[model samples]
Target: MTTRRLTLRQPVMDDAERIALYLNNFAVAGNLARVPYPYHLADARAWLRTWRPDKPAGETGFAIDLGGEGFIGQVGYHLDARGETVIGYWLAQPFWNRGIMSEAVAAAINWYFRVTAAPKIRSGVFHFNKASLAIQNKLGFIETGAGNLLCLARGEQVRHIDTELERSVWAERQDA
Candidate 1:
């Protein structure tokens, strides 16, 4: 999927280097639930090697590509046990605050809803990450509740603000 400033493409083995570069930073990894503080090329390679774009189930990963800037980040979604699609995304620190994440998210969510029959997309932002929270709100995700999750970056359980965007609401917004 192409956003105004980004192209959301499938992750490839060669993207491991760029992925490791950006995700290695504590600042970028801290807000995420799974990525460890010291992200490595080996980890990136392992992840890319296992990615299945043709899979009938599970999360689909996208490498966020900036036209000339190369790979900058990732955004994707997977269905939880309850059948709700869970959205996840992150961007490199140098690219932060440029509205890149917001645009990538909008495009990903738009494509997700179009291809899947899921009713809503669920997301949780670590409480301290105000930027992510702001993006979620700006994209029309309303808080459903709060919970705690183990953050590998922080190596502890942190409070997370949960939110969801129903397909009906997104469709209405698109129509307007």
Candidate 2:
């Protein structure tokens, strides 16, 4: 999906190197659950290989290109065994506070609801990552009182879980 400020497209092999750099930043890595501190190219290549876009229940990653800046971040949604679609994303530190992520996520969420009949998209943000929480709120995702523990890049334990956004609520927000 494409937006005025960003384009959300599938990850290409060439994106691995850039993604590895984005993943390696300690500031960016600290907010995510699985990204390693010193994320390597090999790790990025392995991740690219594991991606299966054709699977009925799978996670699809997208490169968030801010026109001239190449890929500033990545976002995606995956179907869990329980049939819930979980959304996740990470942006480069330099791109933070620019409203880029909000636009990318809004586009992704709209596309997901359009392509599939899923009623809602779920997201969990690490507690310390207030920026993520703000983004979710900006997207009209209400906290459903859910929370869980997640391991960070530094092997530090963090509580990183929350909220669900039903289609009805999303529609209402869009209408407003």
Candidate 3:
């Protein structure tokens, strides 16, 4: 998906170096619940291996690019046993607060709702990560509940806010 300032494409092994370079930063890893602290090249390589570009949908990840600058972040969804899609994303610290993520996420969500048959999209963010929460809210997600998750960067469990965007709500947003 191509936006005015960003492009979302399937991730490949060739993007590992850049992915590692950005994810290695604590600021980038800290907000994400799954990314390990001191993210390594090996981790990037392992993640890229999980990419299935040909898959029609479900749990597919994208590498976000900044026009000509190349990979700057990652976004995707995780499909659970019950067929709920949990959206997730992370951007390099250098690109923070630039509207890049907003654009990238909007594009990803639009594509997901367009192609996937899931009833709703689910997501959760650490309570302290206001920026992420705001992004999800701006995209029309509503608070569902709260819970705790093991944050790899913090190396402990942290309070989190769960949110979801049902297909009906998403359809309304699109119509508006």
Candidate 4:
């Protein structure tokens, strides 16, 4: 899916270097629970190869393009057993606080709900990550509960802060 400020496209093998740059940054990785710091080119290639497009079982990734500068960040969703779609995203430090990630996420959420038959979309932001929480709230997500143990690839435990947005609520927000 494409937006006025960003374009979402499938990640290519050549994008490994750029992906590695932002995914490995401590500043970026510190906010995200899944990606490991010092992310390498090999990890990017592995992720690209493993990410299946045809049978996307609720989990899908996109490269966020900021005009012609190439991939600036990534966003995607993972489906849970209860049919809720959980959204995740991160932006390069250079692109921080410019509303780029918010645009990318809003686009992704719209696409996810329109394409899939899910009843709701969910997202978790660490308590310290006020920027992300603000973006999610702006997109109509409401706080649902408290934190949980969100696991990371680097064997670190992240506090899973709360947020949820039902389809009905989202529809109402959009119509408003």
Best by TM-score: 1
Off by over 4 Å in 2: 56-58
For model 1, residues 4-121, the per-residue Cα lDDT tens digits are 7788889999899999999999999999998887899998998888887795423786889999998999998777667666899999999998999999999888888888787888
Clashing pairs in 4: none
Model 4 lowest lDDT segment of ten: 147-156
Residues 96-176, model 3: lDDT tens digits: 998888889889988998897778889979998999999999988999999888899889999999999888888898899
RMSD (Cα, Å) of model 4: 1.9
* lDDT for each candidate structure: 0.88, 0.83, 0.88, 0.81
What C-alpha lDDT, on a 0 to 100 scale, does residue 49 get in candidate 3?
Answer: 83
Superposed by TM-score, candidate 4 places the C-alpha of residue 78 at a distance from the truth, in angstroms, of: 1.5
What does the lDDT read for residue 1 in candidate 2?
Answer: 75
Tens digit per residue, CA lDDT, model 2, 1-176 = 78999888888778898889889888998888778778999988988887665744226768899988898889987765576778989999999998999999999888877777777888878888898999999898888764565556868767766778899999998899
Model 1 ranges off by over 4 Å = 81-83
TM-score between candidate 2 and the true structure: 0.92
The per-residue C-alpha lDDT of model 3 at residue 59 equals 74
Candidate 4's residue-wise lDDT over 3-101, tens digit each? Answer: 988889877788889999888877787788767667898888998897766746358878898986998888987765566678888899999989898
Off by over 4 Å in 4: 80-83, 150-155
List ranges where model 3 is wrong by over 4 Å.
80-83
- TM-scores for every candidate against the unseen true structure: 0.95, 0.92, 0.95, 0.91
State in Å the error of residue 4, model 3: 1.5
